[model samples]
Target: MKLGIVITHTDPETVFNTLRLALYSLRQGDSIRIFLSGKGVDIDKIEDPQFDVKGQAQEVLDAGGEFLACGTCLQLRKSGGSQICPISTLKDHYEVVRDSDKLITV
Candidate 1:
């Protein structure tokens, strides 16, 4: 299964859980694409000692999960994006949603 995850929030716990799910899906032999929009592009900055979002995200990436970040959103926040949040466009977002077997928005 190809899973698409569209994230528009910056809440640490939420983002952490989202990444956890992505990792799990990847382990299940599913492909995952995570699109970060709005404040979600700030995922690299989320620092929660308990959640370990960055760690989980890295695990997901290592497990073959992909990530995309809204270019406009990054520009609005003055960010050049990060390893886990590469700059992307609406077309990429649309493709993820269009191609995935399932889509989850958070």
Candidate 2:
């Protein structure tokens, strides 16, 4: 199944867990796509307490998971504009939501 997970939080721990689940799903032979919205687009700029958030996100990418950061959200960030994850709009997100077999928000 194709699972789409939308991440809307800026918390490192929370983002860590969300990516963890994405990795797990990939390992289980499922396709996963994670979208960053709101403050969640700041993952590459913040410092986590214990986890390497960006590294974890890279791991997710390395493990064959896809990532999308909201275009408008990226533009709003003070440390904005990253070439790491591709930028997409809410229209793209809605199409993913419509096509996904399962949907989750974190």
- TM-score for candidate 1, residues paired by index: 0.98
C-alpha root-mean-square deviation, each candidate: 0.6, 1.6
Q: What is the lDDT of residue 64 in candidate 1?
A: 90
Give TM-scores for every candidate, taking all chains together and pairing residue i with residue i.
0.98, 0.89
| Alpha carbon deviation, residue 78, candidate 1 (Å) | 0.9
lDDT (tens digit, per residue) of candidate 2 on 36-57: 8888788777687697788888
Q: Which residue pairs show collisions in model 2?
A: none
- Give the range of the ten consecutive residues with the poorest summed lDDT in model 2: 76-85
Report lDDT (Cα) of residue 1, candidate 2: 90
Candidate models: Cα lDDT each: 0.93, 0.82
Tell me the tens digit of each residue's lDDT in model 1 across 1-106: 9999999998999999999889989999999999999999998888988899888889988889999999999999998888999999999999999999999999
